[model samples]
Target: MTTSPLRRNTLKLSLLTLILMGFVLSGCSGEGESWNGKDISGLMPGLEFELTDGQGRPVTADQFDGKIKLLYFGFTSCPDVCPTTLQKLGQATESLPTEAQDDVLTLFISVDPERDSPERLAAYVDFFGNGIVGLTGKESQLRQLAKRYRTTFGYEEPDENGNYAVSHSSAVYVFDREGKARLLIRPDLGVEEIRQDLIALAKADT
Candidate 1:
């Protein structure tokens, strides 16, 4: 029996889709429980930063030097990505053993410093129900850090209602215990996958 034209087209499309998926999976999938994120261990985009914490204290990246860190650039008012990623980071780390959990820290650096004051950052960070350390600083300092990390963020003009929006990078940067940037995790990765990767990175040098 001859197949219909529609069925032939469908088969072709499905084959093409599978080919594309194979390429993506091969390029993106790290070793399941080993380096499950994109390995940038030797890359220099996320070297360091000098910023303030949620409580308005002067803090620098080196201050978190000895611990593994997860860094993301966003604002308290971010409509979705920032908060969700923070929660994922929180949940993933919490899945670790107590001692392993202690080895990891997540930094939510505010790209909208003008609106994300220390007080606002504290409330926003706390609302996520985890131990993320909120941070913000002068635009100049943040801008420099963004440049170094290749993270981009900017504010749109305010609307008639005096509201605005920001466009920023959504990559989760993982730094090892030695302060060397290691993995660039995609925000859309699965929670379990991230949990496993976080554990692997945290214990890599320990």
Candidate 2:
């Protein structure tokens, strides 16, 4: 028996999601990976980009190079996953001691520039709280940035009612103070585990 192309793609996506989800679940158990995250250091450290932030200011690597950055790609219209992930991140950092939480930054970059304006991004991200920056840019700029991380995202074809989902990565990419890519935080990671990881990074020597 052979699988149709569409079916094969769907199956592959399902498997990938399950595998990533398992990693998140195991990692959140406190019995799993260390608070430092599953070190991916020195690998794919090419996390650099300049985009317009929600406030209409240029956001560049230099501006954030000395702090730990948690980067996520998603859009505002996502029904569940996007908001949940952002909320989890916010909750994870909210109760940390001021110093620890202050040293870390979360960046939510929209993949749906076609409909996600800076104002829209601001509203979505602000709901989470401070220390989180909402960013969006020209579609070309976004693609280049995503390419650097080997992450893929794009708008799906609209149905008759013009509804569509923007296919995007949900994993959180963590970078150390030195700006080296350190960990890829999965969605299934609990708020506690995520908080500890950020605190660990925040408290480290600058």
Candidate 3:
């Protein structure tokens, strides 16, 4: 007995749907592949700004023209959030392929320039990893950079012991090769999620 034409067409449609579903699942399952760091393309097409590095050197957005940049704002004295986030970023960078690694830059900018001097900032960043750059400058300059990035930070008064805490935004801003802001990752995100987003932005064609 032969199958009816209607039944045959129904089977064909069902098979096609199954194939499509498989493709979608495969893409989602291999999200890790995007974290390899070579996939950010056209994410942040073009943007430019100037800020100081931990060493007091003038670091401009142009310096990162051909690479993906992870920009974070916090003071050196940040007791918890800053260090934790930076460490996670270090891990994500380590997980990238070498070629992609070379194209990645992580910048830590001090919002409390009154206390976080260039030397102090440099030392703080160096403790994390090699590719991480620390940045601090005049209060005015630092404030300008923070404003451009829409990051806010403030320092609490010191206690009787002359120690205080700095409270600041903990979002990691991802910029494409051209310096445009592409995505923002909060400190609470999983390391894997951060890695995957970075990889996807890196693979973009900007």
Query: TM per model?
Result: 0.81, 0.82, 0.73
Q: Please give, for residues 51-166, the per-residue lDDT of candidate 2 as tens digits.
A: 99998888887688777888998899999989999998888878788767777888999988888888999988999898899999999999898777766575656779887777
Error of 2 at 191 (Å): 0.7
Best by TM-score: 2
lDDT of 3 by residue, 23-91 (tens): 334444344333432222233234455777665788777877888788888887778888899999998
Residue pairs clashing, model 1: none
Residue 39 displacement (Å), model 3: 15
lDDT of each: 0.76, 0.78, 0.69
Among the numbered candidates, top lDDT falls to: 2
* Candidate number that wins on TM-score, 1 or 3: 1
Assess the local accuracy of residue 86 in candidate 3 as a C-alpha lDDT between 0 and 100.
92
Tens digit per residue, CA lDDT, model 1, 48-162: 7778888889987788877888888889877888878888888888888888888888888897888888999999988876668999999999888877765556666687987
